[model samples]
Target: MSNQIIVTTGIYDAIKETLRRKKVSIHEEKRLATELRNARQVLRRDLPADIVTVERKVTLKDHTLDFEHEYIFVSSTREKLKKNKYSILSDIALAVVGYKVGDIIDWPFKGGNRKIEILKVEAWEE
Candidate 1:
């Protein structure tokens, strides 16, 4: 009696395993890159810069909020008005009256600058 054995190498199995590992590594690298980019953006946005600071103490009934900070005003059209216009502080106060500190806001007018960060809010009268 003679014993005979048959063995074969699986090309498909090897390729599948290699592809699976590569896919996992690619996904991990992408996730890490996204996290790093997000951290950098947050740092850049929060850090203070050299600009004009306009501090305004806004009072509405009994509530008061101190808006003190420097901001950049970008407008496409800078037209001089015949009548005197509202100051930047007054415009910001009107836009952010009901908002609280640490809230992100966006106010878009015909031609206006957007203001962020209420800073501090207090309750007072007159």
Candidate 2:
């Protein structure tokens, strides 16, 4: 993944609030801080359709395990215990958000760093 990331203003504001109101791991805090610094905030309509953001459905492939996962990235308040919904504060979401389909990154999963590929991005529907 590139050093720079693009995010909608809403998601950007949510992230900033999350950082202030919630306690996260030091690594996550730093990672998010860096992302905020390098982020290019834009209006939702101005964002590209392929980019991943909160409320979007994303399909990801784990290169090392050869596994596929699907998730709907949601804001913290909107997150649920459902299997397919992931909070933006989650490690996977944090690593993938602001990125677009086809981007790959090495993320620190529960086991260790895994090579993950963003396969698809779908807009959310209410």
| Candidate that scores best on TM-score | 2
Q: Model 2 has how many clashing residue pairs?
A: 0
Could you give candidate 2's per-residue lDDT for residues 1-126 as a string of tens digits? Answer: 766789988888877887787655666677788889999999988989889888799999999899999989887777875757888877788878898888998765556668989999999865
Measured with C-alpha atoms, the lDDT of residue 61 in candidate 2 is: 96
Q: Predict model 1's lDDT versus the native.
A: 0.30
lDDT of 1 by residue, 1-126 (tens): 001111112212322343455532444334323322332121323322221112223322211233444222211132122322223223443244223444444444225334354444433122
Per-candidate TM-score against the hidden true structure: 0.27, 0.84
Model 2 misplacement above 4 A: 109-111
After best superposition, candidate 1 residue 37: deviation in angstroms? 37
Q: Runs in model 1 with CA error above 4 Å?
A: 1-90
Residue 13 CA displacement from its true place in model 1, Å: 72
